[model samples]
Target chain A: MTIGIVGAGALGLYYGALLQRAGHEVRFLLRRDFDAITRNGLRVTSPNGDFHLARVLGFRETHHMGQVDLVLVGLKTFANHHLPELVAPLLGPETRILTLQNGLGNEELLAANFDAARVLGGIAFLCSNRGEPGVVHHLDQGRIRLGEFTGGLSAYADSLAATFRQAGIPCEAVADLPKARWEKLVWNIPFNGLCALTGLTTDRLLALPATRDQVRAIMEEVITAANAQELSAPITTEFAARMITLTTAMGAYRPSMMIDRAEGRPLELEAIYALPLARAAEHGVAMTRVAMLHALLEAGEA
Target chain B: MTIGIVGAGALGLYYGALLQRAGHEVRFLLRRDFDAITRNGLRVTSPNGDFHLARVLGFRETHHMGQVDLVLVGLKTFANHHLPELVAPLLGPETRILTLQNGLGNEELLAANFDAARVLGGIAFLCSNRGEPGVVHHLDQGRIRLGEFTGGLSAYADSLAATFRQAGIPCEAVADLPKARWEKLVWNIPFNGLCALTGLTTDRLLALPATRDQVRAIMEEVITAANAQELSAPITTEFAARMITLTTAMGAYRPSMMIDRAEGRPLELEAIYALPLARAAEHGVAMTRVAMLHALLEAGEA
Candidate 1:
């Protein structure tokens, strides 16, 4: 299937590179690395094995990329304003928009601008970063859980998941999208916010008994809010412990928000914190810690 | 009345200077400002009126400062471990131990070491900072409410208030020390922690809508916790708004915790956050935001 990648940062570059290597035509709407990638092609360094693509389709403008079967969005949520214009030119009527962005509201944003029926949301448990120019570093997990924005399982999402699997990603289609999203938040809400606020990594945050307890408390808060959202299954309090255990192995992992804060970039607070908080409040659960965390993060922004 | 000023930072220096200027014998147990104060006396810069006390009584060791009528403990709560040793030599049998430090557990710490009945906790609303060793900058608000640790008004506490008033400090004696402390915390728990964590001043913190709302929420949480402790009367919710308005007039004021965090000094988390949280929990109320704030502050500490 032909694919177009928008907001091509590390996720777009790495995943796009993988698809291209698997014999699919992949095009990237590039910004920062456009020139270098156009001149030098794309280089990917991965634990799976390092490979360099000598001939790559890298575009400075999305309009130049024309239409494709699928459009993958990897834009930072803070830059969501640019999504409509950037993703517009890459859409074919059959194109399914899949946003693998962190936090909530990505699919809704895409669905509102494009076709609500065609937008799919996916949670990528991927650890990757852009190195220099034209180089993408894939450090760890590359699994994708695809689901329909309107809820429930769909054949197209399943096929897309299979397509991701064919490109060497551990991909699966989830029946309950909100549950998957909230389950992901069971980890993101605590680790991302705390890490960004304190400049501590996952392991170090867990290493200190104080913050470690905070991490646990925040996780509990998130799960309580998540369970209130009427998901297919209640995210048990036990899920928090599982997330903590999973993150313990990611030793000193600096979350993306931490890097954003240190580099003076605006945090993705709106999508990651505010929206989730509002949604949870709709379900009659208030997350005080998350709100305080969001406020602290927002107040510190320039 | 002879008074021994222990932990003579800004609070100690300014109040000690005032008491001495009022013709009370004031001896300061000094550290950072020992040399300058001893060599050139003490300089107080204040909106109330600027004054310089020449030939001030300064001591390098507490032993040199003989027993006095009152022992004013103005040390940072983080430095409370040294209070017993520091105040030991300066104690007279009838000397009232009055601590004007921020946060909870301070009065208890002193009461345990010295005479329990003679221990008093005073909430100083003074805004002062130590400058250039011997200088104390008293910016605004020097009102203090003195109360006994064992609770309720006392004849001795009433007299201390009158003495402080004679020294030109706005002072009052309170019937409920715990209630007064918690009311002070209704402001401190939010402003101090938020300002210190974000490196923003009180005005800057309230300038943002998000943080301002957070300030209100935290104040409510504190008040809720405060009310559960069986205060003489519940702190009305309107108190949070009044505190906000009062803070607004003080434009760009930096709480002491913010300054301490900026200077890489340890925060008074144990007294300000942990102790209040634990105390509140004993009454079956929990403060998630305060705990999270405490954990974030603690984890970031070296």
Candidate 2:
């Protein structure tokens, strides 16, 4: 299968490398890593095993990448302004677009702009970061729970999930997309917002009793909002504890937003915070902690 | 009456200089400005007028200053650990220890150590900072609302208010000290915490729509808790707007906590956040944003 990777940051580069190495023709739309990747090929250093892909297809423009079977978007939502133009030429009539961006509204944006039927949203539970130019570091967790933007499981979605599984990414095709997005937000809203806001990793945040209590409270707020959305399953209060336990096992892991802020980049606050806050307000649920965190993040932005 | 000033940072210095200029014998137990004040006297640069005390009384040790009728405390709450020793030498039979400190619990601590009837707590609305050695820059707002820790406006409290008014400081004697403290907290918890956390001053915080909304929300939460404590009057929601408007007029004013953070010193989180949060919890009110802000402040501690 021929695939076009848009917004080739850490996740794009890492996953694209894996897919390409698994015998799929994966073309990456590169920015900072363009020259390094095109010249030295893609290098992925992972806990699973280190692999170097020498015959890499890296592009600076979507027109150059042409059409492909699938278009995987990994753009920071802050940079979503460039999406419509970037993904325009990399489309065929039956081209499926999978967006693994964090938070809400990514799929809707893609669906509004391109083919709604071809749009699928993914929640990637992957811990990774970009190294020197061409290099990508996969620290841990690369499972994806994705579904159609319009909701439910389709054969095409199943086939896409199978493709990811073949590429060594544990993939699941879910019956509900918004539910999966909100579930992902249960973790993202607290850890990512907090770690970015406070410059503390997951472990350090949880180590301090005050912050640990805060994380739980914020998670419960998220759950309250999520459950109000009337999803297929209510994300139980127990889920907050499970998340805390899972995060404890991840050690002192920095969320991607934290790394982004460290590198002096704008946070993806619109999709991750503002949209979800709006949804909560629509459901007559006031996510006070989340809104406060969102405001602080915005106020701190340079 | 002879006055002994404890914790002579900014407020102590400014008010001490004013009292000394007004023909009162004001002895300041100084730290950073001890030598400069003792040798070169005290300089106060203020909007009301500029003034200098040529024959300023300064002491390095609290014991040297001895006991006086009044012991005005202007210490940062973070430095409250030094209170017992620093204040012990400056107490008389009826010292009337007025703590012009930020947040809650100052009166409690002082009352526990000294005579409970002699303890007074003042909610200072001053915006000022320490300058070069003996100099203090009085920016704006020197009005103080003070009362007895045991509740009600005592004769001592009224005399203290009259003394401050005579010394060119706006002063008011209130009946409910806790309510006054909590009312001050309605402003402090949001502005001080937000400014300290985001490095944004009052004007900048209110200029942004999201943060302005957050400030209102936090103030409302504080008001909810304050009302639950059975105050003489409920703080209306309109008071949040009034506070915001008042702060807006102050123009990019950095709260004391913000300055403390900027100077690489510890914040007065216990007085400003923790104690208030505890009281709110005890009253069965959840100050969610306030708690979250408190946690972020704690998590971001250097």
Candidate 3:
């Protein structure tokens, strides 16, 4: 399968390298890393194993990539405004677009530009970072939860998941996209937001009892919000506890939002925090903790 | 009048200078600033006027200072654990103690050490900072609200307020101490916490509409919590608006908590954020915004 990876950041490079290694033609749309990637290819250092692609196709402009069978968007959600123009040149009539961006409204943004049926939503459960210009570090967990934005399993999503699974990336297809987003949010909103706001790692946050309770409170608020939105994905107190345990086991991981903040980049506040908060507000679910965190992040950005 | 000024930071020095100028014998109990203050006296650069005392008394050890008519406690609330020993040397049977620190439970801490009847509460509505050792910059506003801890007017409180007023500091005596603390908190919890957490000054925070709304929301939460605790100081929506307008006029003032954080000093989280939050929780008022902010501040301190 020929695939085009947009926004060649850490996740884009990690997944593109794996897909390319799996015999799929994966082309990366580059920006600042264009020269480095084109000259040295992409190098991925993962706990699973290290792989270096010495020769790979890279493009500075989207128009040069032509059409592909699938377009995997790994851009920060803050850059989604450029999608209509960037993704236009790479889309065929049946070119399925899978957005692996963090937060709530990426698929909707893509669906507004491309076909709704071809716009798939995905949550990357991978701990990864771009170490250098063309190097990706996969710390742990390389799972992708994929689903249709409008709900239910799609043939394209299933096939893509199967391909990802074949590449040793545990990809799961879900029937409910909103539910999946909320479930991801149950973890994302608390961990990512707190890490960015406090500049603390996952282990540090879980180490303190007060902060641990705060994380649980934030997760419960997300679950209440999801239930209020009528999206049922078994998000419960037990699930929240499981998330805490899981993060505790992840050792000392710095979340993506924290990395964005550390690198002086704009946070994915609109998609990750504001969108879900607005939905929750519409359903009369007062996510005060999340709202305060969102406000602080927004203030910091300003 | 004999006055012993404990905690020779900005507020302590500013008030001490004014009291000395007003013909009261004011002695400062210092720590790191002991030598500078004793050698050079205390220099206050104020918008109102510049004044420097060349022969002020300073003591490194609390025991070196004899008992006085009044002991003005101006230490950061985080250092209140050493209050019993520090204030013991300066307290007589009727050496009325007035705590001029920020946040709730300060009067209670003083009351625990000294006589409950002699423990007075004060809210300093002054913008001041220690520019250097023995040097304080008085930016604006030198009014203080004075009240009794047990909640009523007393001769000691009245005389203290009169003394402060005579020293060119506008001091008002109030009947309800807890109400005064809550009223001050309606401003402190939001502005101080937000400024410290976001690293944004007053003007920047007020400049953005979203953050401005957040400030208001936080103030409202404090008001709710205050009302829940049965302390009614007329902290209404109108009062909150007045506070916002007042802060807007203050330009780009950095609250004390922000200054403490900038100087790498531990924040007074226990008194300022935790005590009030615990009280609100016991009263069944969910101060979720303040609680989250408190947690973030606590984490940052950790």
Candidate 4:
């Protein structure tokens, strides 16, 4: 199977490397790391195991990448505005586009440009960061929760999940995409927002009782908003507690948005904060805590 | 009239200088500024006029200040934990303790330590900062809205207002202190909290549409929270508009909390953010935006 990886950041490189190692033909659409990866290939250091792709296909422009069986978008949601054009050259009639980007609305953005049926949403439950230009450090939990943007289980999704499973990455195909997105937000809105705003790592945020309570409150608000939207998933009040326990075990992991903020990069505000907020507002769901977090993060960006 | 000034910061020195110039005996309870103020006297550069007290009374220990007819508590709300002991020796039976601090619960904190009748709350509608150890740069609007904490008119309030008016500083004695604090919060919560979190000035905040809307949203939430507590002032929806207009005219003003955060000083989160949030929560008022701001500011402190 031919797979094209867009925005070869940590998430892209990690999964791309894994798939390539599993004997799939994977090409990384690169930006700043183009020359580094092209010269030295991609190197991944993971708790699971260290893997190095000594030589691989890389592209600075999408026009030359051509159409593939699948295209996995790993771009920061802030950069998704360029997606319609960037992903245009990589789509065939049956080529499915899977986005593992954090936040809401990425699949819609993709659906707006490409075929709605071709755009799939997946939430990456992983802690990883780019160690250098061509290097990715995968901390823990490399599972992909896959779903169809418009809902239901599709054979393409099953095949994709199968591919991920074959590559030794856990994958679960979910029925309701919106619900899955909201479920991801139950954790994202608070952890990502607080980590970025406070400049605290996951463990440090959980360690402080004040911040820990705030995190729980934000998560509850997200769940409430999700229910208000009638987007049902496995999310519950217990999800907050579960997140704390999971993140505590994840150690001092810096979430993607936090890393983006620290490195003076554009944040995924639209996907992670704004779109969910808009949905919640539309449903008359009161998410005051998340609203404040959204405002602060927005102000920080400004 | 014998006046004792607690917390000898910018607000303290500014008013103390004015009162001293008005032919009143003013003694400043100094801490780190003791040596400089004692050696150089209190120097104030104000838009109204430049004033220099060639020699002034300064005390390192509150015991040396003795009892006075008026005690101006000009400390930051975060520093009010020391109020009970700091203002102890400076109080007489008739001593009126006026706290010209920003935010809620300041008067309550004072009442907890000193006599309830003796505590007054004043909102300093002025822009000033400590230029140096002994120097205060008064930018504009030196008027103070004075009110008795327990409410209603009092002789001490009248005298204090008269003294301020005589000193060329406009002073209005308000009927309701709690209401006035809430009214001040209509302006304080959004401006101070945003400026502190975003590191943006008043003009910069208003310059961007997104942040400007956020500022307005936060102000509305504050007003909602205030009304929830039954502490009503003249803060209508128009109050947010009025504040924007007023702050726009004030040009680029770095609010006190912003300066404190930038200078690595502890933020007045309890007084400005937390207490109001608790009140709003108690009343079942949904102040999501303010709650988020409170969380962000609190986390920033952590």
* Comparison by DockQ, 3 against 4, better one: 3
Number of clashing pairs per prediction, in order: 0, 0, 0, 1
Which number leads on DockQ? 2
TM-score of 2: 0.97
* Candidate 2 CAPRI classification by DockQ: medium
Model 4: per-residue Cα lDDT at residue A172 = 83
RMSD per candidate (Å) reads 2.0, 1.6, 1.8, 2.6
The TM-scores of all predictions, comma-separated, are 0.95, 0.97, 0.96, 0.92
Quantify all predictions' global Cα lDDT against the true fold: 0.89, 0.90, 0.88, 0.86
lDDT of 3 by residue, B178-294 (tens): 888888898899999999988999999899887898999999998888888766445688889999999999999999999999989999898889999999999999887888888
Model 4 segments beyond 4 Å from truth? A92-94, A228-235, B109-114, B228-235, B279-286
Residue pairs in steric clash, candidate 2? Answer: none
RMSD score of candidate 2 (Å): 1.6
Stretches > 4 Å off in candidate 1: none
Screening candidate 1 with a backbone cut-off below 3 angstroms (N, C-alpha, C), the clashing residue pairs are none
Docking class of 3: medium
lDDT of 1 by residue, A106-172 (tens): 9989988888998899898888888999999998888899899988888898888888899998999
Name the better of 1 and 4 by lDDT.
1
